[model samples]
Target chain A: MELITWPDERLRRVADVIDVFDKALREQASKLEAVMRAGPAAVGIAAPQVGWLQRLVIVDVTARKGTNNGLLILLNPEIVQWQGSVIGREGCLSVPEYTGNVVRAAELVIEAQDLYGESCRYEASGFEARVIQHELDHLDGLLFTDRIVSRRSDLFLRQGGA
Target chain B: MAEHWFMLTVVGRDRAGIVAQLAQTLFRAGADFGEASMLRLGGNFTIMLMVHFPAGEHSLAESIKAVAEHLQLRVHIDPIDSHLHENEAADVVVSISGADQAGIVAGVTTRLAAVGLDILNLDSTVAGSEASPVYVMRIEGRAREGIEALEPVIAELQREGLDAVLHPVDMLIA
Candidate 1:
């Protein structure tokens, strides 16, 4: 599936509330999981990335499984409580090839729905928690670029030619 | 495949060519890096790197001796195997950012001290406007023994108006 381009309008609108858990929705989520697994070192994916602005996300840290923390998905996610501020660098597939150091909550207790609309709660920390917060912000139409503390502090220009 | 682990330490006076010269020495001795953490505070350059190689490919003791002679830097190496590789420690990751102030580190470490946390690694940098610096700190270490439940105490520090976060280190895939 081709990535949704910037300014596609779908990226900005408040994503549609996922109200149904029918086969079509499940199929869409499966495609998202496939895309996420195939992408470069990504831990999460959102609907807007594929031009579907339904409140949905999927994440699995199983690629590094010895830590006993992996595989999570959030549909219509909402962060109910957050404590502490953390500064870390993040990269996005949508932005593609640019990374910025942005500050986010070190831990969060979030409420979200699953693909089947069953409610789930997530309490995460470290990089896993960061990934959740980053993707959820995308549902609200916010990108990491907006949360970046500064252009130079966390931003890096990847070397290409040299 | 032969596997060996060693705790390697490098300390020398701060200078521009230290890392380059050290890298050349390591390359010549054929030591592969397993994990590395380095810092420059005040005038001292301190380095701790975990290195590994095939079980019998090289003698770690002899390699350290050669690198020490070549680089003229204080270097120490200790060998360990599967039973004592120090795999059982927890880690705490802290992130802090605010309009830079002089007391940022003081405030953070003070809290950690009150909670009985022993910091193992810390990396911090400052950026932002010249007038107002944005200070960030990332810490990796095990939570202090017997004080694993102090996250809320740490959380309370947020009310003082600095962006602070503390959490257990999670799957560092890279």
Candidate 2:
């Protein structure tokens, strides 16, 4: 799967919601996982970023030291409930040039479907929650750059493998 | 369509509708707004913007000057190179905070330069009473050498009675 970069019109298109849970879906999820792991410090990836217009994302933050769930493969993921707010720095693969400080819901309840078409719901907080929200934005064609607190102060270039 | 771009800076005492008035003038001139930075420092509000106008129009600076005069604000406009682009992603975000003191910016920035890091963007403010103000600055920049090179600089700043931390800018998403 090819990773779509910024300025590509496909990156701006809202992805289609997944309805059928089949082998194709599983294969797509696996491909996304491989791409995410290929990066230096990637924890999450979205379908649109791989040139697929589907509401799918893969998140795994167990490698980092903190509170986290091992791995989450979400299809049509939705933030059912959220509370509080926290500001943190975020960088995206599609927008590889810069990182920005974005305010995100500190804790959230996300609902999605597993590979077997089984429903899954999870409660997450801290960096794990931030990764989910960042990936979810891709389903609606929104980027972290769009949610930056301030263009003049919040935005910066990612340096040294960022 | 032919277009011309200019960097405009305005500074004056803070007041209502200053932005609206300037925007109106630009609107009437058929100019488009680009990246802009506006802030209120003390009692003065300063604005800097990149404006694009259709080529062959009347002088944008002259028109803006008239509006600036009416609003009692100082304005400066200069032609800018539109081909310029933003720099690559920075390696770390450096934050510094302490009791307000003279030469804090100079001391910190100069130290950073010595380590081969460029200050891409910096925002600083002094809060609290005039007698005991607090200074806070957030700087983002790339390390020309590497992260290892910045460790000593951070330590030096800490020794100077300032709290400093350098955070790596990680690409969280693939």
Give the number of the best model, judged by DockQ: 2
Per-residue error (Å), model 1, residue A85: 1.4
Q: Docking quality tier of candidate 1?
A: incorrect
The superposed Cα distance between candidate 2 and the true structure at residue B133, in angstroms, equals 2.6
* Clash pairs for candidate 2: A157-B89, A157-B90, A158-B89, A158-B90, A159-B89, A159-B90, A159-B91
- After superposition, the stretches of candidate 1 with alpha carbons farther than 4 Å from their true spots are A65-69, A153-162, B1-174
Residue range A1-162, candidate 2, lDDT tens digits: 978888888888999988899998898789889998887588899999988999999999998887777899999899999998876778888887566678889899999998888899999997899999999998998989899884443343222111
Q: Local distance difference test, per candidate? A: 0.67, 0.82
lDDT of 1 by residue, B3-36 (tens): 5767778887776777776766666677676556
Fnat of candidate 1 is: 0.02
For candidate 2, write residues B32-51 as lDDT tens digits.
Answer: 88778888998898999888
Error (Å) of candidate 2 at residue A30 is: 5.5
Q: Candidate 1, what DockQ?
A: 0.05
Docking class of 2: acceptable
Instruction: Quote the positional error of residue B157 for candidate 2 in Å.
Output: 2.1
